[model samples]
Target: MSEITPDLVRHLGVLARIQLSDEEVQSLTGQLDAIVDNIAKVSEVATPEVVATSHPIPLENVFRPDVVQQQLTREQVLRNAPDQADGRFRVTAILGEEQ
Candidate 1:
């Protein structure tokens, strides 16, 4: 188990260029100690035989097979366009840029 001390917290604060008060130093020492202890507990349970996983439950992709089929033609698609030019849909120029 790793033990976090007020002196270590103060040193970290100095390295980080942070000005910590005595109260902050004491509080961070306890907080950091708890974090380290919890991490150690987790490490103890994580053995080499145990597989690491991002999720508790198994995950799989539910994908449909890719199949090609007949689709609409360009003229059929352009029939509903409010405005089109040069065999394609056209819109007003934006941001003062020209085509």
Candidate 2:
């Protein structure tokens, strides 16, 4: 088992700039010790022969072939615009009077 002492918890609290009370340090020491022990158990089973995987089941990517299709004309697109100028949509200048 990992030795997560109260002193270690106090040192970590100091490093993080947090003022941990005596009660909090006692509580965290037990919690951190349990977490470290569990991690050690997992490490034991993780060997060179065992491959690390994010998921239990295998997954594959499904892709579709890209195909070109008919598109709308410039006039058809500009017809839905709120304002148009020189065959394109026009909006008020944001930064200055220059367009």
Candidate 3:
């Protein structure tokens, strides 16, 4: 059995900046112990030849090939703008600077 003592839980709470009550600490200790045991069992079955994967099924990128195509001109893009300056969209200064 993995050692999941109350003192360990208390130390973890302190490091995590959480105020855990005694009851909560006691509950978590058992839950965490079970989780650790499960992980240990899984590790025991894992072999050196077995491939590691993040998902159960094979994955592939389902994206279209990147290709340059005809795009809207700057004039067409800025046509709906409320304000324009120097061939670019203009907005109010927001750096607390007087404009």
Best by lDDT: 2
lDDT by residue for model 1 over 11-63, one digit each (tens)? 99998889999999999999999999999999999999999999999999899
Give the Cα-based TM-score of candidate 1 against the true structure: 0.54
- Provide the lowest-lDDT 10-residue window in model 3: 90-99
Clash statistics: count for each candidate? 0, 0, 0
Off by over 4 Å in 3: 62-99
Candidate 2: worst-modelled 10 consecutive residues by lDDT: 90-99
Residue 84 alpha-carbon offset, candidate 1, angstroms: 41
Could you give the C-alpha RMSD of every candidate to the true structure, in order shown? Answer: 11.5, 11.3, 8.6
- Which structure among the candidates has the greatest TM-score? 3
In the range 3-84, model 3's lDDT, one tens digit per residue, is 8888899899998889999999999999888888899998988889888879998899899999999999999999999999
Go through the candidates in order and give each one's C-alpha lDDT: 0.92, 0.94, 0.91
